[model samples]
Target chain A: MSDIVTAAMLVIGDEILSGRTKDRNIGHLAEMMTAIGIDLKEVRIVADDEDAIVEALNAIRARYTYVFTTGGIGPTHDDITADAVAKAFGLPCEHDERAYAMLAENYAERGMDFTEARKRMARMPRGAVHIDNPVSIAPGFRIENVHVMAGVPSIFQAMLDNVVPGLKTGTRLISVSIHCPAGEGTIGGPLGEIQKQHPDTIIGSYPKYLDGKFWTELVVRARTPEALAPAEEAVRQMVARLTDSAAAI
Target chain B: MSDIVTAAMLVIGDEILSGRTKDRNIGHLAEMMTAIGIDLKEVRIVADDEDAIVEALNAIRARYTYVFTTGGIGPTHDDITADAVAKAFGLPCEHDERAYAMLAENYAERGMDFTEARKRMARMPRGAVHIDNPVSIAPGFRIENVHVMAGVPSIFQAMLDNVVPGLKTGTRLISVSIHCPAGEGTIGGPLGEIQKQHPDTIIGSYPKYLDGKFWTELVVRARTPEALAPAEEAVRQMVARLTDSAAAI
Candidate 1:
């Protein structure tokens, strides 16, 4: 409900920790959250161990406005995130009647047996609301501040889209970028001054050595578009002044 | 110097924290370390701030056997990883004569000016060794256990390939996957029993709901090829037994 919404991402699975899978979720979520004006504060990757999941869930959920977790919601023995979430929140995890019914209906339509293993998909923690998975009927759940979704990029992305509109958004985040061929030290001092002048705006510099010259890309971000304009102006002025100084030297 | 080789990754930039870039480096490093048996225990991502970089460097370098950092090593104003690494070790970060010589030669060969901004690429933390960047001349650094590499995938992958073989390796990690059309709970008991039998092996289950049927993918990992074979066999047997139970029910 605050003006600034802060969130943390918990990437679950040994694939991520073991490096077998290069996670595309973190970047996708970060970009989406920023566009919606929610600040992503931290990201932690943990193995699919229940204790680790529970511990991380408790810590992150308590610290941030919202916690988004991906992976381990599957019908496999290693899928323990749902149980962990229930344990972390001290809630009951049982097969939801509605979820089971939906699963049964979905499987029946495909002429598949609603086996016990499939029933695991119907389990939900008490007081949790399901997030529709259009790609797959095994719905993701939202318990308190924690939103548990699938690990697959396509499914995870689909689940996130469904969850975002329901979230309480803060001020819209806006940013501007400028590319300059200059070293950080040459612009570090003046950039600091610009930041001090525009305390509300956050300025970032990314330096790249391309084509044998150092080019620094400066990015300015703010909650309001108005706040971004002055910050951009100050950056331009400082970069020009730094370029001139280097020329004189 | 320790028998147990360890590694950590330092990610620099505010973009990662602000959720603009979902970091791909951590997963890549984790997988690579596992393959070589380096034992990646921890990872940290910090902002482009010098103090934050210094703090992370000191902490990780002291604890881990090897430290690998990606991002913020570029030639831009915000790219401060190089300076911060030098400061953390209490070393002078100055333009290395050899590095400058290399840069000048490389640039001249490419018909580009060795401008003052480009000179930033030559700065190295005192006593640091260079990690070759086949993609560009802005070499990454290696000091003690720390191996700095570029953030770009193509370049980072190349640098890693160059650096990995040099480090002392443990047993290689191998994995096997088996799919079962059953829920995790049906196999959880047997899965736990198998894990207990093979303490050295890590068994994981990932559940998927596709076409309205629950199917779980179980993966078993071990340090040695021989160990992986037995562990994977045990998982396959357990899954088969669970499948039988589901079919009967």
Candidate 2:
């Protein structure tokens, strides 16, 4: 088995906190991280305050293998992610010539003058590498372990596509989900015993209320299929026994 | 102006971090808090691990006036939130008689046995106040400043509705939104100046990409209409001027 690569996400925007805008980036990033064999351990959403951004960034960056941030990178006064990231690393935030040229040329090609606000998108922490944004011309940047992307869902996704190929990923976690037509209360005790028997697997019981009845979806995940199979079988047996007992009643 | 009441949310569940379940609670809580005159400052989504939950709960609970948590209160081994919250407060977790009676009667009404797993739902920290769960009979609990609720959206909302009437809230913040047909680059500079002039108000510029063109929505928020009006007007004027110039060109 490969070593685990853990990550954390920092979503920076006041619009999200105010509920004016619903966040699409967190789920997308979480799905992408899971698909790419990285464990997304934690996620944080904070307003676009520099102090808040710097504090969250510093706290998570030191703990995780990679840190992904979305939002606060636009051409506005509230867009202070670049400066906050710089402060987190105690490095200088300066305009990157490559990023500036990319935006400058794109705007010029569209017969629009690149204003100073537009130029703000080019700033990055020192020793950063630009992550290309295909949806928009502005580039995201990777400084050390932190990758800062745009808040726009399309742009954030596009930038992540560019960054993924370069990352060192772990082995994909294998998962098997079983639908148990019983509530958590009915299945919890035996499920706990199943979990103990398969110590290498992670078993989670998600309860759902549907059509005036409660049910659960049991998911068994492990670093390898070898570790996952026995757990999956045990869960299925437990579900079958529970359902049989209910049917008898 | 009334004193600000701040809050942070701690979302606990492995399903959320695994991307198997998309969170609806964060946005709902944010909007509700905004409407009820509470400042929702920060949000953290963590897995169902006990140490992770305790660490995050301890960190945010100390900083905010109130901390609201969702998930991991179910009747399963993975449902470790009550234990973690108890540990965070350095209090012993024990079974509460009131909660036990509620669930025992709920199951009895349905002609079902109150199994051991079902009884697990009655556990709570010492000195915790029960938060009524109208949807499901199992009760959520509040210990000091932390309000713990179920992860299900419907149940979480119901539990919060019960808790809100008793909370000390701040003065409601008024918001004015203006849609700008121009991109952030066109309105950012002037918007910054408007924000500086109206230091008492908060101006947020949200960029949206639609129909292959970029536009912006500017929201100005303040504790009163008196502080919100001038900033809102300034943003409107900036958008109007920017659009006129683009049209002329």
Candidate 3:
């Protein structure tokens, strides 16, 4: 396994494209991946089209260590993600006997009829391992490096919580942040020098305007607390330098 | 003048890719475009890499009616959206005289020194027009169909509010939603029939698991309120039929 694990998120839904629903999965996944030391490299939102999903899955899965997809795994006409994933991997998709049994039991527990539409949830790509859905009995699945998940924030989150613990992890992430009312260019050179000095730390600067004055919030993250302290100190010194430079100008 | 007014979003930042930031701009732009009758066909989140931004800009600008980009318009070293935009359009990027004047006045009002880094905020691609920034003096710009705005939610939102009023709107969006405790497959056929019957309305189904039970929320959207009613009724009838069928099962 590579020292640095990377992942990409694919959000599939026409509802998202039409703006009928706001997507909450990206934020949830980003935070989760960060906690587990997996670097999330890119995110793409596409319609519920099979061609789009297949294209995105093929592109991202080949590039990243893991590819997580959300939405379009439901018992609906538009729920084509399973088919797309199967097509992407060139795998066979059929109703898994195990998944169907679990769905039947779940439906019986709720005193609901397991209609043919509901049965659609049991269809899984051949050779895929089922992901436990604690909130809903309809299991998500993992085939090759791709993890298929539901789009609902709460359920998706729960499913991710279940799935992440099983994956290999690197060092835990640690971070520190500082704020200054100076533009980035004022600190750019110094910041670049500090980054050069601390190659292990990731330094990010976000600029914002508060009370009609420009300000920036700088954050430094590292794999260890030891590596983070020097980065934080370097950032603090750079911010101070920038502040002084601003005052002098 | 095109019958189909299309738009694409350019999200610029490494923070988003690094999992340091979860973007909310795409959903915001998607909703805004739908409401104003502009079709938001594609969205791409590129890192703050100049070459990548230029490549994405060249690809999307030629295909869409409008391109709105969010992020990287900050006063940071990595915030190179303006430079990349200028490069993409093959135009010289220089400090806009009007924007520089406005920013100078803004800094003077707060008794702050307008450093050279702060002057970077005034830079725009040649022949670009400034979009008013009610929140800050870092004005966004519109060069042809491409509108570049800030990435921060509050600032992006304010910039959009100001920019939207000046654009031409073709239709007002109206929507109707109904919740049914039935799976989508049960309703998929009926939903398809309804869509066939009313070709004007867009009917979508979102399946969710709430309180440990499966349910689908069906929505109908159209240009007119009257069209919404018929679509809504059709969905209702479809749901009723599905429920009846499930009961028989």
DockQ values, each candidate: 0.31, 0.74, 0.45
Model 1 docking grade: acceptable
Give the per-residue lDDT of model 3 (tens digit) for A1-249: 457788888989878867778888877787788778887767777888888788878988998889899998887666888988999999888999999999898778867778776788889899999998887778999998899999988879889988998887766668887986675645655666787799888777887656655577788888888899988997887767766774622
What does fnat come to for each candidate? 0.40, 0.74, 0.47
Provide the TM-score of the second chain in candidate 1.
0.89
Candidate 3 lDDT tens digits, B51-157: 97998789789987788999987665667899999999999999999999998998788777676767888999988999888877689999998999999888899
Assess candidate 1 and give its lDDT.
0.78
Query: Which numbered prediction scores highest in TM-score against the true structure?
Result: 2
Model number with the top DockQ? 2
lDDT tens digits by residue: candidate 1, B154-187: 6788888889978988656677878877655456
lDDT by residue for model 1 (A175-212), tens: 88887666453565567678788988888876555654
Scored against the true structure, residue B202 in model 1 reaches a CA lDDT of 84
TM-score of every prediction relative to native: 0.77, 0.98, 0.87
Flag clash pairs in model 3.
none
By DockQ, rank the candidates, best first.
2, 3, 1
Q: What are the interface RMSDs of all the models?
A: 4.4, 1.5, 2.6
